[model samples]
Target: MSIVVNLQSKAKPETTTKLISFIEEKLPAVRGFSGCMQVSICLNRDSGDLLFYEKWSSKEAHEKYLLNIQNNGVMAQLMSYLSDPPTVNYYESLDI
Candidate 1:
């Protein structure tokens, strides 16, 4: 089964609009990345909470993707719109 990755961050209020535009522009490359099944962004308007919902072929694939972004400065660019460092959690489906 694919792994689900949830990445959450609080956007700086002033930059929230720009952040959404940035994510929209960047989503295509992410979706085309190897092992990425799907990815989407969700935002809470009132609280400025941003969520990155992703599915990948496996944990290793997602890790590889992270390393790619980190080394390429994409991660740094993305972080600049946020109020603080983001939190990430990976999930596996239950047999039920």
Candidate 2:
């Protein structure tokens, strides 16, 4: 089954714009990753929250991507822009 991952990060107000830019720059590579079906970003300027919505072919695929990111230091790079740890949640789609 396809899986959805929501990643939410709280950034320092001063770093929010740079953080968004960094993610935007890296999005194409994310979108091109195997098993990635879609990716979108949301920013709450008032709250300095950055959200990533991603859909993958399967939970295993998403886990592979997570491993790749960790191995490549991408996760560390992203964390450098955040004021606190990110919140990551996974969900399986429910057909109506």
User: Candidate 1: where is the Cα deviation over 4 Å?
Assistant: none
- TM-score for each predicted model, relative to the true structure: 0.94, 0.92
lDDT of 1: 0.91
Which TM-score value belongs to model 2?
A: 0.92
lDDT of 2 by residue, 1-96 (tens): 788999888888888878888998889989999999999988899998888899999888888988999999999998888888988899997776
Identify the runs in model 2 with alpha carbons over 4 angstroms from their true place: none
Against the true structure, candidate 1 reaches a TM-score of: 0.94
Find the candidate with the highest lDDT and give its number.
1
Q: What do the candidate models score in CA lDDT, each in turn? A: 0.91, 0.89
Lowest-scoring 10 consecutive residues by lDDT in candidate 1? 87-96
Best by TM-score: 1
Q: After superposition, how far is residue 60 of candidate 2 from its true place, in Å?
A: 1.1
**Model 1 Cα lDDT, one tens digit per residue, 65-92:** 9999999998999999999799999999
